[model samples]
Target: MEQKRDDTARDAVPAFDWDPRSEEVQADQIAAYDAMRGRCPVALGAQGNWAVFGHADNRAILEDPRSFSNAVSAHLTVPNGMDPPEHGPYRAIVDKYYTPWRMHAFEPTCRRIAHRLVAGLARDTEVDAMAALAEPFANEVQCAFMGWPETLHGPLREWTRKNQAATLRLDRKAMSAIALEFDGYIREQLETRREARTSGAEPPMDATTELLGEQIDGRPLTDEEIVSIVRNWTVGELGTIAASVGILVRFLARHPDVQGDLRARRHDAGLLARASDEILRIDAPLIANRRRTTREVEVGGRIIPAGERVVVLWASANRDEAVFDHADEFRLDRNPADNLLYGEGIHACPGAPLARLELSVLLQELLGATASIEPAGEEPRRAAYPSGGWSTVGVRLA
Candidate 1:
């Protein structure tokens, strides 16, 4: 039976204080999500926030952007932090860049990069997949998409690492410093492009150039705004891709039979992509995304007052027994029609198509190139963030 809300209970809701940075705490996140889904789907969180776990309730909150605001920070997600009407325009700019044609154009480059990375690992007996393969693969692809030099990969990776640390700290000073560093870099690049234009050289088709061409709210985007958008992508992409690659490889290694089947059905890359979604459903990179409640709303039979923070536990919701049968098992045949890995509604990740394309291509390349993959000696190191996993992954290729 679901718990009912009371005036006394409203004053003090039973909640869990989760320190995402702690390894032990991070390990317990899944268990916490499970327990919350089983008993109190909408419980109070440590920071006095409402945590929503049930699949239906989480979907409701995500879909109803008016009831739960996404505008947590300005200058950083443009409209990822915006709601509905305000979000539409900014999102259009991003959506255009991720159009199927544009992503398809990048496919050859993506596949070449994946093949090169895998080839590099071909000689090594045992490798840290995160560093040797995933990081470089993602960094290079991101650089290619931005039309930036591959030389920027090192600095970009370092900056992403620093930004993740700063975000986890939620420190204003560190964030400001990082912002300045990125701004300086981007401005210098813009100036160089301007100079090159005077020489009659055309700038490359890339996000930076595209953003420079975009008009938001009927005004051209400023350098700071462009930097903020690019910075968000750079900071968010690497870790998740690295973690995802690790998870996929680990999953394949554990189930060679499934790997063989996918390899045998190479013509069904789309099916493989769907199977990848199921893999994500079983071990979602992100545990939860935070939203602010607009007013008093009843979710999972509990009342969340206005001005309260709501943590939508997508990881839990994807595995909710009410929504998925045998939610804990990894089944490649499972349909991902309702998966929440990329989230839902207006704020759903706009770069999802690009990400999916990249992951699909990467897996396809791997299946074609390698005979088999088996676990190496070392255990993988998981990231501290709720959205992160596998700082280091050990794997041996057959």
Candidate 2:
């Protein structure tokens, strides 16, 4: 039967079916999303936006960028928030940074950072993995990748916390302020590089400095554009990467059989990579990504009108039982293409190569260095919306 669209759908708002920010939903995001997928796959959220929960629906939205646009925000977001034609040039520049050669060259530095952090983890005692290892690993690796100094690590970590807090509260004012604060950090770095170049003191040819020489449309990228690009990259590294570590460690700590298998295959990069991706698929690190409807569209029996906002729920879709048998089961045999961990389509994460490298190396080092990692006596705290994984992953490393 053909689905009927209401004539007033263009102006009429749909009644919200779920409160995404409610205490109930936030308490157990994965379970709540799972229920939502079954009850209302395309839900009208309390935030006045639609949350697409089904895997097929989410994939369709991601692939059909024309119907669902990426220009969801008014503020400049470089390639991430731009549609095609406009997004292509900036994306080209971003992709160059994460090429095979770059990832291979940066592997030693990444491994070194991971090894140092893993080595410092206390053995046979309860520790908050997020603070003791995950956060620091992400911060140091990100800083090292961009040629940022140790001084920025503390500030960057704190900034990420504030950013997540502001986002959860939907505090636009606070978010704007935090955005400016981060921009200041990037601006200072850009200025320092420019000053060095002008004063005849050679600036380090790091990622930041390399951005200075990048050209688009025959003109050098503007400072604003550069800062936006770096800001996007920094958020990806600091937020999602850290959450992924917590998830990976917690999963390994709980699943002894899988942990034992991965520990044995620590030297096999391919197996380790697939294992990390599979684990993260079971417990997503990034909750959802935003999009706007360019035209009226039907998704999972719901009609989202033109100009409306939609959130693609990665946490929900990746674990949809329809897509994967026993969605929560950690199986290495699952097809990699079906996993939306790094996303799909044109707007897929440009930093996936770098992210995969960091996670794979960190796991190898962590598994190689420790005899065992298991959950502590204390309960783990789940991160709220806009963030995924545990906030305090209480675990004992031995």
Candidate 3:
């Protein structure tokens, strides 16, 4: 049967079935999401948004972009926010920047940054992995890759913190302020390039500069479009990259045998990459992605009307017990295609190749630098909504 719809859309929808921001949900996000996955796979959430937790339901939404539109936000999101036909050309542009050749070319610099950060950690002391390792690794590598200034490292760090806080509260005013603040930073880069073009001075030929010259639909990309593309890339570098590092380090720390096994096979990049994906599968580095229903749809036994908001919870779906044999167990034998770590379908993460390279290099460097990495006395503080992984991962590096 097709989805049944009410004449009136959002207002007619029932009140939120679950409170996503309640203290209970924030206490332990994975556990809470798992509970929802079992009890109500397609749950109604605050603000008329529906949270799809089951692997099947989430996969359905991801596979059928027509039914679930990507235009969920009012703000422009470049390729990510645009649905198909329009999404393809822009996606092609993004894809070229992260091709195998490009990643291979940049691998040395990425390795150097990762090595420097890992080597500098104080020995025989407890270090917050988020600070000494995760955040800096992301900050430095992003700057190197984008031809951005090292001075941006601190400002971007603060921006990530502020952005996360504002998002969790769903504070539109603060979120708008945070966004404009980021735009100012990007605008400065654009202005500098414009000056370089006028004065005949050379600006670094990097990703940002390349974007300024990119054409779309036979016309040059607007500053708005360029800024949006860069903003999405920023989230990947600052948010997901840092989160992945903390999660990777903390997971290895908790599983000593796995850490030892990885240390022994450190030179085997493919094996190491598989292990990284498996670890992240158990604990996702990204919590969710939003979608707006394009038509009335039935998902996981729930009938969602057209124009309703929907959220695909990666943290929950990747760990769905139905898909993976031992959902909670970290094992490398599982199929990579089944994992939604880099997502699936056309809107899949474009920076995946770069992400893999950065993480693989970081893993090699991190394992080589440490005699052992073990959890310190304090528990790892989990980051709340809009951010995944630990906010502070405490570990003793010896």
Candidate 4:
């Protein structure tokens, strides 16, 4: 029962069922994605890539890595942009960096960063969650995690914005420039370490310095390789982390009961973490991930040819009515395994442990610091495509 479409559909490609960057979608992404999921789960985009919005389709795509490859990027992305046989080995290198022991070791520093940000928020006043809270917390934590200097905080924030703009424009030149700009920052740290080692002086023992000693296939990781790896980690840590903060803060503001419940049990780390996942599941922070088809596939009654592009819309899939009965309701009792907050299959997020820890700690601090969190005067502004969650959420803390 595949939906019939002529070769012209293939020729035009992204016959885009809907514009991801449209003013309508940008105005209310969740509603737009939800409507698409219900009406047309699988559709070709304007660029010819099939947009998969249903939960079942996304799960099947994620599970069948053989048919859906992760090598969607032209640039090197360490483990994230590689496919199996190659993916597993590089993934091993990335996994060693996020072990429970590492997260435990980093918790104190992570909490200090979270606390400093939360404590700085003025009480009973209107504050832009993205500017005064979310962005700074994400930036400082990432810098701390990478063992980068505090001087990098401002540049990295600006870099995230430029990277997002470049991505939205699909401007390879701007993308390349921003990427090199990022590389220069990373390379500066690497050079400092090299100089310290040459002078027989000890360098700072941090993640960046530790990465210098890592080897893949029995050879030390090259500067280019290390930069690529760090770049991937930085993007994951900074961009999504900021989005998650804004989303979480706004969610709490909108739902006072949920906020009050969590505030009462603020000491319960496990409950708070699960709540974070549920909140994110209802409103995704990272919208979509791209994949390339290895073979022809039939999904959601549509015929997709081989060598085509695919976009898995997490914001829609997680809220698919088929899976979550109410879809939008925040329920703490829902099964955690079913949630795709960290993705699925071999390419699942390796930094999830660290992310969970950061989120749990941040929520705990916010609840403890403020008596309540509620919406401020202006309506929360949704972020544009390529980014999910609120761009500017005004919240009043008391």
Candidate 5:
């Protein structure tokens, strides 16, 4: 369905194209969002999609699942891709896995992983934080959560990178090949778990078990559904967590005052958590989330027709001046209002608590062990998609 335009409205929203991979491209994307916010809070884009750039407008869209749906696919993000009523029960199956209590139980293991990763960097004066520490740290924690063999970490990381590349590829054959490879990987894991169950050994407490045990609408989920959910988790969690760590470290390095304050307040996990939120606001891992309009609706005074795809620019919304004062600067003192980094509404990320726990422990371990972190010789590389950050961030440990 195409979006309908109101001829009576005088102001015409400008069209903007974006390529998120290049720093120049990203800067331009931000500029475009800022420009749209200045003119109209919500505007129509060149792709015939509605774009909500202002903080308030973005929040409204996120909070109203009835107005917008989360079922975007080929990008099946469990629960992340399901709408309410239908989405609620499926989400509940794994919701408890990320609660504060559950996170607390996982803390010791998280801390251990962080300590080991940071300690490994101690031997090297400078290391690529993304590859040497962040990626491995996220991978190990994910492995711990899924109860999968640790050997899968390397392949998992590789698969995530390939999946991102596949999304950007113009060739259908390339994309299909990547999808086939990942499907095979998931099938292998499922077979391994089934064998364990047959042998009467204790089945692992990982995502596979949790997913296998889950019943949607009182019937067990099919293997295809399980694979879809796990694939989303694997693809979404690993790279983003690794990228976020790099962003946080890079921000601290550039802002010594903030770094010093964080280090001084090391004992306060709450403060550390707030600091993480502020960092996320400053440099979001994902630029936007794609959602398709289900029915004709009005947003920001513009009428959006059904079936048109919309890209909610989360990074722009996080920094919108309407909701955040001094929105451009990183201010830890700012009240961390619900930022849409983990998304919102019925599609709000179920893994948020776990991600938060991993990040907090990583920061705590790094601050406690190292005096300071500085950029090494390597230049930072951003991810191919609009939804990711640094591919490599080298840091010199002090």
Candidate 6:
């Protein structure tokens, strides 16, 4: 049944259920979201967006792409921001880059990076995992995967920090500037590749260069489209991947028994991968994705008007008690198809396979290399909205 609320009038604006930026929510999004899910399945947030907290509601919205449009932003976001017929071709192109063959080919490179990072950890000392390992692994692996040079790593890391800050503040001017800044970086790479190919020089055949060759509907993709696609990929790689690392580390440290179990089964690649997904499901890394309602709809007994913004709380939905036996408990045997870690429907994350490979490999290396990973004396700081996981995760590796 729809929870009690007097704002069922056709055009009436629903009262705000929670302040997204309040101290309570910002301090601990997981706990705050879980509480909100129980009280208000479909809530109107202080930011004028409808926050859908129930697993069923979130799933319904995701599956019905026609009603909940992905075109929430004024700017182009490649396939992610496109819908239906428009989203298909680009999505197909993106999917090719993450095929089984591609992931298999990239596994060795991923492992070498993971091995080196784990090897460098200072044993028995408190190290800020975000700084010491998580951020660096995210940066290096993304660069390596994209075939970007080492010099771009520092710039990309700094750019991610600035982008997250601007997003949290809802600074439009800063966001636009940041977008342009990223565009410049990607455009430079494209131009350099174009020049290399033009001069008959051997250009590095990386994802960026390969994208230059992709044709959509018998036409070459525009620079705007290419840049947008690369921007999205980079954001997922650098931001979400890093966040997943911290969340995984924090979970393992807090649950030593689970950690030991994982360490014991580190050789079983399939188990390791499933275990990573389970851990991430318990503490989502990507947070929510946005959509706009095309027409008035009732979600979880709440009337949402036409053209309204909806935020599907992935961080909350994945942990819904109604869906999972024990929402907060990590169980590898749980159904993988039910987990929305990479989301669902056509808009599901295309980069999921690569993310799984990266996280799984890193966990294996970290667990195999160290005898134990425990919490440090320092408290970890949680990342604010628009980012999930810790901003600083201090752990002692022994």
lDDT of each: 0.78, 0.92, 0.89, 0.90, 0.76, 0.91
Tens-place lDDT digits, model 5, residues 22-65: 45644345555676677766766554656778777777888888
Q: Which parts of model 5 have CA positions greater than 4 angstroms off?
A: 1-24, 27-32, 39-48, 74-77, 122-125, 170-172, 378-381
Candidate number that wins on TM-score, 1 or 2: 2
lDDT of 3 by residue, 104-177 (tens): 99999999998888888987878899988899899889988988998998999899888888998889999999
Pairwise TM-score winner, candidates 1 and 5: 1
Please give, for residues 27-63, the per-residue lDDT of candidate 2 as tens digits.
9999999999999999889879899999999999999
Report the C-alpha lDDT of model 6 over 131-198, residue by residue, as the tens digit: 88999999999888898898998998899889999998999999999989989999999999989988
User: How far out, in Å, is residue 203 in model 5?
Assistant: 2.3
Overall local distance difference test of candidate 1? 0.78
lDDT of 4 by residue, 183-265 (tens): 99999999999999999999999999998999889999999889989998998788899999999999999999999999999
Error of 5 at 160 (Å): 2.2
Best by lDDT: 2
Model 3 segments beyond 4 Å from truth? 1-14
RMSD vs true structure, all candidates:
4.6, 4.6, 4.9, 3.8, 5.0, 4.2
Task: Put down candidate 1 lDDT per residue, 1-398, tens digits, no spaces.
Answer: 13555666776854564433455656556665787577767777566777788889989988999999997654556768778897888888878888889988988998899988887785337777778878888888888877888778889889877877887777889988987897777777777677777899987766777777788878998876677777667656776777778778877877888888888885575777787788888777766788988889899888778988888887788998877889867776565657999999988888888788888888988888888888786776556655555666777886
Judged by whole-model lDDT over C-alpha atoms, candidate 4 comes out at 0.90
Error of 2 at 127 (Å): 1.1
